[model samples]
Target: MKAVAFVGYKKSGKTTTIEKVARILKEKGYRVVIVKSMHVDFDREGSDTWRFSRVADAVLVHAHDTDALLFRAKDINALFSMVSADIFLLEGFKSIKHVPKVICAREESEVRELNDGLGIAVSGVIASSGIREIEGLPVIDATKEPEKLAEIVEKRGFMLPNIDCGLCGFNCAEMAKLIVRGEKTIKDCVVLSSKPKVTVKIDGQVLPLKDWVQELVEKTIKGMLSAMKGYREGRRIEIIIRD
Candidate 1:
């Protein structure tokens, strides 16, 4: 899925621009998920989930038509594997450089402070100041031309696997900026496009394999599965090893 981060200080119009852009993408039939970053407590005070959180490390409230998993963690990448969407609208994460960004600002000084070579567009109250471009980034009026803003996002936004294998000569975040600037394509990302025959991840991080090692693992697994009942030439199988 492609992801775009909207980042600025509090009350910098990040929410409004994200909402407008999400509406336009939805109208175009793209499934969008907005992930907001905040430090506020989620569960209501004295509620069942809140009470459970006092003793438990995590709380899962299985409410009707919705489910909430409350945990004391702040990493946004934790949700990437759990969520399915065409686009991800990140509400915060100013320091994350892997995804495309729209910098929201109310003044020119704010724009100068926010641009860090990752921003694709500039929006917010600063867009009303009648300026066209700031630091070579387009100034888009999200309220008046949300479609235009959405198109920019659709064109430039991307989510890399962030494996940083170094096969691409640069890091994933650097590659994202190159893609946005027309210097590179998504095809340049080896991890994002790789279809490994045998994959392994320990503790949420993928373990890269050599070419010969991957072939050996794939062959061994296929040979073992070939003798199983109901096994076909191209069947999908999963194995879980636990201590």
Candidate 2:
């Protein structure tokens, strides 16, 4: 999947630009997904819902029909796997890697040393009444012309993944949505930097086995022992060994 992100301070029109770009992409016959990120707690503290009862480090919610995800994470990488889209538009992750992005600037004077970083796909500047283009980067006018933003995304490729796994802290669906909005990234998933593997337990003993041979042996023993017991509903069989 391809991904892009929009980054800027509050009232810089990041959210408005994302919506306009998404609409234009959808009209062009491409499968698009959007991911949104928020630091605020969506669930009320005293709510009676099950999800609210046990507070987790983060919470992710998905809507398949709209192909959107709502992600909440303390860290940035919490939504990597949660995004699923041919093209992902993200809204707010500035610390991740390799994402073609648009930096929203209200004016050229507002540009600072922090804008010197690489990986910026485009920079949007708010013009007087209509959108204007930056000489080296694409510019988006948040107030007058939002559709031009979609043209920018189309020139760039799709922006995110679609599996919606919570390994990133956001559900897969939510990640996709935010990616389109320019809000998050896969590198944000610090958890994935470490490899993943299946865990096994034997005779109430946990084995720290990393090799396939050990896993195969343990699985074979378990399967054999399970079949040897003549077990049925409400009935049990015991095995005795003779020396």
lDDT winner: 1
| lDDT for each residue of candidate 2 in 104-176, tens digit (9 for 90 to 100) | 6666543442243433434444655354445355455644555665666666544332323355677544554
**Model 2 — TM-score against the truth?**
0.50
Which lDDT tens digits does candidate 1 get at residues 10-115? 8889999999999999999999999998777667789888888889978877878998777754345556756689999999889887888999999888888887
The models' CA-based lDDT, in order, is 0.84, 0.54
Task: Please provide the root mean square deviation of candidate 2 (C-alpha atoms, Å).
Answer: 11.3
Query: What lDDT does model 2 reach?
Result: 0.54
Model 1 lDDT at residue 66? 96
Cα RMSD of all models vs. native, in order, equals 3.4, 11.3
